[model samples]
Target: MRNIRAIANRELLSLFCSPMGYIVIAFFLALTGVFVIATRSLEPGQPATLRSVFGFMPIMLTIFAPAITMRMLSDEYRTGTIETLMTVPVSDLQVVLGKYFAAFLYYCVMVAGTLIYVLLMLIFGSPDLGSMFTSYIGLLLAGAMFLSVGLFASSLTPNQIVAWVTATIPMILFVFATNWVVSEVDSAPAIREVLQRVNIWKHMELFNRGLLMTESVAFFLATTMLFVFLTIKTVESRRWR
Candidate 1:
């Protein structure tokens, strides 16, 4: 636990020291703000709303979460810090968990940034607080899952660019391709069912509309844990080689 906290603190500090974190936050805020303005219209009678702002988050997260996590283990290995890290008294699992949690926390900040949009909407118009809360909950879970995938990709290679691309490709597939697959396989009920099951877009659809489904929650949790474990295994396997 002590080691985990130390590792998490180090990771968090690294993020604060780096300019990339600030850049990411700025880009998302600007992009989401534009989305809100466009969706709500420029007219004074049509005030801005949180619905459109939150709607942009999943796509933003799909891109930004990889940027935040793609370097987690890969950068350490690239710079030869992995050796020093491995020599520490901490177990590998603790290191992986700590780093994962730190990245997760960073992603949470990204999600929290959208709160400003919610506040703006509240000032302009009535917002459904319950739906807003559930929507943000869904974003949190989605970000966690994406971060876990990025961590696993980082563990697979010492090249950060390669890790980032690898992490991003599957997310793109999950977000875009699965829907296409479902559309194409109209006659194959079983195939469509499977594609829907694998589709992050399908799972996220309900959440975006403020519908809280247990199955979607379970899917996100399972996907996150699966990738986290994969990352732990990837890191552990390197010890033997």
Candidate 2:
């Protein structure tokens, strides 16, 4: 626990000192703001809400999450600092968790910055509090899953750009590809059911609609753990080499 905290703190400090952290945050907020305006303006008769913003958030995070986590391990390998990090008393799991938490925390901070949109909705409209809370939860869970994927990608390569691209592609597919396949392919009902179950966007949509389904939550949690486990294994492999 102590080692994990130390690594997390170090990762946080490193992120704060780098321009990428601020860039990600700023870009996210800017995009959200634009979406909020466009959404509200385009549907003036509809309730003044952030539904459109939330709808766009998963896609935004798909891009932003990778940018935030691209350097988690890739930079360490590039700078030849993985050896020093591995020499620490912490186990591989601890290191992976620490880095994962750091990235997750950074993402939370970025998400928090979007609170202004919520505040605006509150002042001008009666947004469903329950729906908003659930939506936020869904966003965080989705972001966590994406971050884990990014971490796995980072662990695979020494190039940050490659890590980012690798992470983004899978995330895009996870959130969209399944839905596309199910729509394009005329499959049996059972096959379509399985594909729908695998659709990350469908799970997120459930959350967006204020449905706290256990299956969706479990799907995100299970996938996140799987990637985290893979990242730990990747790190351990490097240690043995």
Candidate 3:
């Protein structure tokens, strides 16, 4: 437990000390701000709901998750720091979780940046607090799952760009392709059913509408743990190599 905390602290410090972290935060705020303005979600006399904002979040997370996690392990490998890290008294699971926790904390800050929209809504009109609350829950869970995937991708290669791309492709499939196929194409019912079940956006739909499903929560938690374990295994594989 101590080792985990130490590792998490180290990672967090590294993130805040670097320019990339600030760049990511700025990009996130700018992108979401542009989205809200362009969609007129904050326009006067319009609905006070952030449903449109929530709807666009999966796409934002698909990009930001990889950006935040792409270097967690990959850069350690690139700089030969993994060897030094391994010599420390830490289990692979602890290392993975610690790094993941740090990334999660950073992601939370990114999510909190959206609260400005909520405040704006409160001022302009009455917002549905129930849906807003659930929507945030969904976003947190979704970001956790995506970060785990990115962590696993980072463990696979030393190239940060490669890790970023590897992490992004799966998110693109789940966030974009799944939604498009299920809603747009006249695909087979079986295929559509499968896609809907796997689609992160689909799971978020109910949360955005103030309807919370245990299934959605379970899906995100299960996916996050699955990938975190996978990343631990990937890191452990180096022992055999």
Candidate 4:
């Protein structure tokens, strides 16, 4: 527990100590703001609901999560810090979890900044509190999944750009490939249903409609754990390497 905290703090400080974190945050907010204004002006739905902003998050996360996590292991390897970290009293699991959680938390902060959009919606129109809360829950879960994917990608390479690219590709596939699979398999409703079940878009859509389903929650949690475990394995494999 103590090791995890130490590692988390170290990971977070590394992020804040650099300008990239601020730049990524600023770029995300700017793009999100543009999307909100464009979508709202063209078709002003429920006055100022955060649905539009939150709706855009997966795409943003597809980009931002990779950027944030690109440095997770790659930097340690590049700086010859992995040896020092490995020699520490902490186990591999502890180090992995610490780094993973720290990256996840950072992603959360970026997502949290978008809450200003929710507040803006409240000021202009009456938004459903229950729906809003569920939407946030969905967003948080999705962000966790994204962070895990990015962490796994980071574990595979020592180059941050390579890590970012690897992470971004899978997320892009998840969004587009799922949709494509579903579309091409209309003849196979069972397969289509399964594809949709595995699709983040479907689960996220439920939250957009203000419905919280336990199954969707489970999918995200299970998927996140899968990636986290994969990241752990990837790091541990280095011992044999």
Candidate 5:
């Protein structure tokens, strides 16, 4: 536990000390702000709702989460730091969790920064606080899942570009292809059922609508854990080789 905390602290310090972290945070927040303005979500007399902001977040996360996580393991491998990191007296699981938590925390900070939008809605108009809270929770869970996927991709290669691309392709497919598949496929109930189950956007819609279902929560958590487990395995395999 102590080692994990140390590792997490180290990772967090590395992130905040670097310019890339600031760039990512700024970029994400700016993009969200632009979307909110362009969509007129905050116009005077506009209904107070964060629907526009929430609508843009999944796409933003798909891009920005990969950029944040692309270097988590890829840079270590590229610079031969992974060897020294492995020699430290920490278990692989601890290392993985520490790194994952650091990235997750960074993501949370970015999400939290967008609360300015929420505040704007609150001060200007009457909005449903319950829905807003659930939407934020959904964003956090979805971002964590995206970060886990990015970590797994980073574990696969030393090139950050490759890692970013690898992480992004799956996210894009998960967000866009599921709906396409459902629309294009011949009406096979079993196949559509499975795709809907795996469709991240579909699950996220429930949260966007302020409908908190146990199944949606479980799905994100389970997938995040699976990727984290995969990352640990990948790191352990490299240690052996």
Candidate 6:
């Protein structure tokens, strides 16, 4: 437990110390402010809901999550530090989970900044408290799933760019591709239903409506664990090298 926390702290500090981390977060917030809040949230006489923020988050996460996680294991491999780290007392799973949680923690900080928008809504109008709380729960779960996917991608490649693209493609499919397929094609109701179920963004829609379905929570948790397990296996592969 102590080793895991140490490793997590190390990863978090690296992000806080670097310019790229802050730049990505700033750009993410800028985009969210301009495109989501400015366009829909701050309008007069509109429903005081975080629907716009939650609706826009998956797309932003598809980009931001990859950018944050791209360098985790990939940079270690690039610098030959993975070998040194592997020789330490910590186990492979600890390294992976430590880094995974670090990325998750960083994401939490970024999302926390968006809470200022919630405060803004509070002053301007009556936002549904229950729905807003559930929406944050949904975002955290979805963001964890995104971070896990990015961690798995980083475990696969030594190059950070490859890691980013690998992670982005799956998230894009989850956020956009499935929706487009269901919406554009004149498919049967059954097929569209299946596609909607597969769409990750669709799963979070319930939370925005203040409904915490067990199935949605299970889906995100199971998928996140699956990726984490895959990353552990990938990292373990290096033991033979």
Best candidate, TM-score-wise? 5
Tens-digit lDDT track of model 2 for 2-93: 88888899999989998977988898899888987787723446676676678877677779888988998999999999898888677999
- Misplaced by over 4 Å in model 5 are none
Give the per-residue lDDT digits (tens) of candidate 5, residues 50-115.
776787777777899899899989998999988998898888899889889999999999888989
Local accuracy of candidate 4 as per-residue lDDT tens digits, 13-48:
988888988898888888988987777822446454
Where does model 2 exceed 4 Å of error? Answer: 41-45
Deviation from native of the Cα of residue 70 in model 1, angstroms: 1.5
Q: How many residue-pair clashes does candidate 1 contain? A: 0
Residues forming the 10-long window of minimal summed lDDT in candidate 4: 41-50
The lDDT for every candidate, in the order shown, is 0.82, 0.87, 0.90, 0.84, 0.89, 0.89
Distance from true location, Cα of 10 in model 1, Å: 0.3
Model 1 over residues 1-241: C-alpha lDDT tens digits?
9899999989999987899878887887788768876787333577333655565666676688888888889998999888888887878899899999999988778768878877766776677787778788888888899999989999989898889899888787677788788888889999899888877777766776778999899999999999999998888887888
**Could you tell me every candidate's TM-score relative to the true structure?**
0.93, 0.95, 0.96, 0.94, 0.97, 0.94
Candidate 5 local Cα displacement, residue 195, angstroms? 0.9
RMSD of 3: 1.4
Could you give candidate 3's per-residue lDDT for residues 1-241 as a string of tens digits?
9989999999999999999999999999999899888889988878888888778888788789999999999999999999888888888988999999999999999889889999988988899899999999999999999999989999999999999999888788767877788897565888877777887878888899988899899999999999999999999999778
Model 6: per-residue lDDT, tens digit, 1-241? 9889999999999999999889988888888788655658767798888786688788878888889999999999999999998888999999999999999999999988888888988998888999999999999999999889999999999999999999998788767888888887675888887787767777788889998988899888998999999999999998897
In model 3, the runs with Cα more than 4 Å from the true position are 184-187
Best-to-worst ranking by TM-score: 5, 3, 2, 4, 6, 1
- How many clashes show up in model 2? 0
Q: Give me the displacement of residue 117 in model 6, in angstroms.
A: 0.7
Q: List clashing residue pairs in candidate 5.
A: none
What TM-score does model 4 achieve against the real structure?
0.94
Segments in model 6 whose C-alpha atoms lie over 4 Å from true places? 184-193
Residue 231, model 2, lDDT: 98
Worst 10 residues of 2 by lDDT: 41-50
C-alpha lDDT of residue 15 in model 6: 98
